[model samples]
Target: MTTPFVHPYLPNSAPEVRAEMLAAVGAESVEEFYADIPAALRLTGDLDLPEPLVAEADLSRHVRGILGKNRTRLSFLGAGTYHHHVPAVVDEVIGRSEFLTAYAGEPYEDHGRFQALFEYASLLAELLEVEVVNVPTYDSLQATATALSMAVRATGRTRILVASDVRADVLSKVEDFIRPYASLEHVPTVDGIADVAAVTALLGDDVAAVWVSTPSATGAVETAMTQLAEATHAVGGLLVAQTDPIGLGVLTPPAAQGADITCGDIQSLGIHAWFGGGHAGFVGVADDPRLVMEMPHRLFGLASTSVEGEYGFGDVAWDRTAFAHREEGKEWVGTAAALWGIAAGVYLALMGPQGMVELGETLLARTAYARKVLTALPGVSEADGAVHLREFVLHLPRPAAEVVEELRAKEIEAGVVLGEHELLVCVTEMTTQADIDLLARELGAVLGTATDATTHTPVLEEVAR
Candidate 1:
């Protein structure tokens, strides 16, 4: 006498519809579909799930309420992914139906998509000062892995010397990805920057590449690029540099500094930090055929079509990609973050060379001001003497994780915790002078250095203004 159950969201969950599907699949009941699964491993009872909300309004409200508990106040957390202001135009361009829905396709069928990616590559190459750039990979970690793999194949060597200060997560990813093909040796650093003498000592005939990062994991700029490049080249090894594309406006491009290959993320380029969803990797190299041929991802190029005054964009060196040779390819290639490439292209177009320079100047000023203000606190000091652009490290008297937890209760995301005493702080154009002052004041209060009166005035005045 009881009516059969039917899921409001899943029409196929209706008993009659499920019966029909089971019949079509030559199965008597849903249990028959799990016949291949081992009896011991098979789940015997329904999963412990909450009752489904059948009403659309109820589902929406539930999701919103859960998300509402997350802190939405001032934040300064930037290790790899950053919080930059994404322009409305960039969103509008990428949100178009064709771009939002389309994946990889033929140039003849998806000419607009091909052209957009070609433009993205061209723009990124200019920023990196390299002759060629591939379509974006999954994220910067993948790009770094692929770059190191290329270095190993190019020099026929098995050892890679990585700077000791590289981000822990990024280092782990590279180590795991290159474990089968090569080995990694950590090079020491002084004052948070790579030590030229240390790198020189590590270089040898067996070294395939020297991996370094500008504004390294601790946010220290590597000032010894020229010396490092000479030392690496002396051993016939390549210099592979991972850099932030946003900082290239002011910092010297890796290619100009003698890096054989360059790779990094494009998350700062008009991409929203949707809780770590907005990362895409880029790899660049000079026009050398040997280096270019080793790239595993798709490369889009511009060509003149048969029609006069017409240009077409299509894949360059198609044979080198896994798409053409499958398992025989140099590395396995799969779906790329092509949409983010398009988004980045839109960002670059909006912020021409001048806009980029202005942005870089703003970051430099903000970062220096923040360091000066925060270091004035009682138990806080600069982690090192190295100059930084947008990110810097601070030494806290207390454990960094404990301090971060306390700040979170006040609805302020302090920064990324590096260790017990080290906290890596990042500043972007989006972080206002008032926000910086607020952070400094709260931090001083937390450290028992700031009085109630001093911490309250500047913030009030700035907010009132």
Candidate 2:
């Protein structure tokens, strides 16, 4: 059977027209084009795909029906990406054609685009309390790897130390990029935060940098960063911070802690998790020109013009990207992700400093309430002793994966399952007190042996680290 050209945008060519084109190309059949693909590897049957819809309305409804099946859960799951409440105006401003367009450094056609990104970097710099911030990278993982690369370049060292509890995805990316060039080391964590004592023990002349993630994998805020920074610097190594941009609203800025390079995902600012839709990454440089010069991606700078009080946005150290010169570029990232950077800038401009602090306080409050409520359950107890802000670990009577599936049946996204025993639950500004109460009730109901949610687990005092 012949393949049906069904999409309205795709023109259906007549058999004679196809024959004429093939004849012109000196080929008798379409199969001739695939002669080099190896007969055994070629598919033997028609693709088992649904027929395409001809009407735009039909296509829209069809897609909607598929998406409608995704249960809008009362979610508490944040292993990394989170579901934050995105304000309405952020989408409105970014959707405008002036800001929505994509490219790298088009000085003439898209000066507004350049300026938007500049404002984003500037606002993020202020929020992070760092001197300089780059235009976004792909995600936190990409930013971490890129930051590590810059550290190695700046310090001229072959050994790098990573906190074992830093997100596994980030470590894998850093390892992928740094291998065959630099050696990798781990600084272990105790009670969900990096063990600062071990970090001091591990730092040496051969080490180029130390990386630690705040509001770490278990959602425990790593408070010992200041000590880690001092130790890394005493040995002449840079401190690289893997952070959540939203956490900076309330937490100490890495720069204040003496971080040489700070990097992470900015997804929580205005971007939605969108069920793992792509997000942009960020890297902020401390007050060092050498490290600033080695930044992996674009850095938009504000400039003053000859006209009185006139200003503009442009690339600083304009030669850093692969856009103009691919082979010799520092990194191969493109400019589309910068669009997310622009959206984030809009978010910051709207939130301002006060809004950021308010957001942080709100998250802190909600998570605290959640931890208090959840731990009251009979079979659920705090998995670690760390004081958490946005997330916490819980030990359940049964397998967390099994519990998660039961919760899913009740329309809840739940938390990350570490194994048969542990569950990493996250709370955000979006998770209301009612949602937390419902979560407590559901977990109590699903565990089969749970008493009412108000009953404290008997081991609470024993595991209350």
Candidate 3:
């Protein structure tokens, strides 16, 4: 006599509808659908789930309450992900209805979207000093993976030499993606940057590319790029350089530094670090047909329209993409981070050349000051002698992880822990001088306490002995 329960949110949950659907599918009951699943593997009894908040208002309140518990803390943690200032204009532009709501619309339907992405590619190409740039990949990691794959295809070689100092996450991604088609070798480093002599030694006929990161994971600027490129080319291999687009304002472009292919993430360009959600990858190559034909992602180009003096934007090499050939394509291309590409385009339009240079200068000045202050503290020292820009390594007396935990308790997020005593710290334009001073003071106090504890603990141990 009990009324049958029906889910308020799920459509066709009513008893009559369920019976009708089951009858239409020639199944007497829902259990019949799971007949293929073995009894041992099948779940039994009621699922351990909270009572459903059926009402929209109740669900909103529940989600808000859970989110309220998160405390906002000042963070300096940047390994691959960074915390940079996103301009208000960038957000306003991306939030528009046409850009935000549109899916993968065609060129005829989404002309504005196509033009916007083309502008983004053009602006990025200008910055990187490359001739051709793709729309974007999933992120910089994917861009790098694809770039290496392109190198393999172009050189007809299976071996890739990657710098040992690349960020761990990026290196992992490249390893996973390239394992099926190519073999990866790590080039050793000297003083935090790639050792050109070692890289030269690793190069051979089997090598397809030599991949290096400028302003590497340890924040050391790679000065031997031209040498590395020459060495790679000497063995008939390509040079792929991974760099941060934000740093190109001051640092030399990878393509200009003898890179055959350049790739990097645009997250630092007017994109908010929403728990690492905001990232889009860019890959650039020279005008050489060999390199351009190997690109898997869409490339936008401008052409003259039927109307005189009017131009139209559309995909350049549409026939080469996975969208056209499916299984036969060089690589699988899925839905891109097109929204983030648009956001980065807006940011570049706003910043222009001078603004970008000023921003780079600001970061340089702030980072130098931070290093000077923190290195002056007792029991704290620089991990490497190389010159750094936005990020650097700090050797601490205490465990870096323990220091990070203590700082978190005080509502401050210290940098990423590299090891027991090594911490990788990042400073961007968002970080102010006062913030740097505060971190230095807190770090000094923590190290002072740790040093005293170590000084006493050893004494007690010696007395016991």
Candidate 4:
């Protein structure tokens, strides 16, 4: 297709352009709408790229050939991204017209994209049981960083204590970004859990926020929120919880656990697990007026009041009554993918609270079962027994790289082992019992067939521990 030049200004809006357009169309009045642009901006030069088009099937086959160069495997890896099964119905439902409204609330300024944002934000607030939400930012890292910056501004504290076993990349990113502004301190871990004593020692006059992750990156659960919140409260600091939304289904929310700021990824909620996004991160605060106003992203709410003549129905708008600054008020163009994806998430949520909980429970149970099966296999063993959420790490008797290679050769994709021996495996609601057995059977066969397989599996098992 040839590129067309669009006018920067409208003919109907500009008197000269309107007259020119009328003359070009041989029309007596402006009402005759068909028009052509002036020859000056129109190109007479030849266009360079793709002068000719290929047949549809040929093009498709070419694209497929390029794509097929990449190897396919039954993925068992999940660090942040999981291979969850997305229902086909999700795509169909998100395409509905009712959900495609823009964020602009007024008739004159109605930008339909913002309405989708508002709808998404409202859905998240209702799911999280928070007063408001802002559906901006591409991922959780931005959300956390923004919230941390806001917390620093609000608290005037230069010291922030973070848990030792937090997500590795998130911590690295936060340290790289936040350390330039304040003193970033790490809370020591006690058996894969955040050490309360270490965090307590670090707290005092200059502390702004205390961050801890639940189901720590090592797969250990932390139940210290109440005390953590109390300690932060006593020292005039905020307790921030970075949660796994999948765990949220079965576990207590940050608000229920007394966390002042609840910030985490919503990736597990009906969004495709493609590259760990396009998931929205939520930063909700406890219902305290003092705390809620400090929330970073602001969602529009339906507010009502009487007009001069009579009562009137107010339309949708972004509500900032409980937010901090004007910068947060900018209308975020709803990423079409996330808005549509999360609407599916709302459908997942609306299927009822029980269904959500069951989804979480099912994941937990299946993950546990898969763990047992993996451990029973020849070269695999459980590395940590720290009460995993949906996934846990395993120690492979063979080198993780080698085992992953072997699995790949067999068209089975397995997890990557961190350090020297640990392989992280995630079992979502999508991982079936059959899939689990397939992994087990494959590992068992790899133990017998490959060169020194018998020796490597045992040697790897010892190295795994």
Candidate 2 residue-wise lDDT at 92: 89
After superposition, the stretches of candidate 2 with alpha carbons farther than 4 Å from their true spots are: 1-52, 102-105, 449-465
**Residue-level lDDT tens digits of model 3 in 183-284:** 888877888888888889888999999999878898788888888888988999999998888888887898898999999899999888878888899999
Better of 3 and 4 by TM-score: 3
Answer with 3 or 4, whichever has the higher lDDT: 3
Give the residue spans of candidate 3 off by over 4 A: 1-54, 449-465
- Stretches of candidate 4 off by over 4 Å are 1-72, 97-123, 126-129, 305-341, 447-465
Model 2, residue 455: distance off in Å is 16
Better of 1 and 2 by lDDT: 1
Expressed as tens digits, the lDDT of each residue in 162-243 for candidate 2 is 7637777777788888886787887778988888888888889888999888878788887788888899999889998888
lDDT of 1 by residue, 1-465 (tens): 024666566677777787788779888876776779999997777679998787889999999999998755688889998989899999999999999998867899999999999999999888999989999998888889999999999999999998648888788899999999899998778898888888898789999999998878877778888888889999999999988889788888878989899998999998998898889999999999999999998899999999998989888999998879988898977887899999999999999999898898899899999999999888899988888978899999988998888877777789999888989998899888888888888887777774453436433233444
Compared with the true structure, what per-residue lDDT tens digits does model 4 show for residues 334-370?
A: 3424463355455554545787688878988898898
**C-alpha positional error of residue 464 in candidate 3 after TM-score superposition, expressed in Å:** 53
| Model 3 root-mean-square deviation | 7.5
Q: Pick the candidate with the highest lDDT.
A: 1
Instruction: Assess candidate 3 and give its lDDT.
Output: 0.86
Error of 2 at 88 (Å): 0.3
Error at 368, model 2, angstroms: 1.4
Off by over 4 Å in 1: 1-56, 452-465
Error of 1 at 83 (Å): 0.9
Instruction: State candidate 1's TM-score.
Output: 0.88
The 10-residue segment with the lowest total lDDT in model 3: 455-464
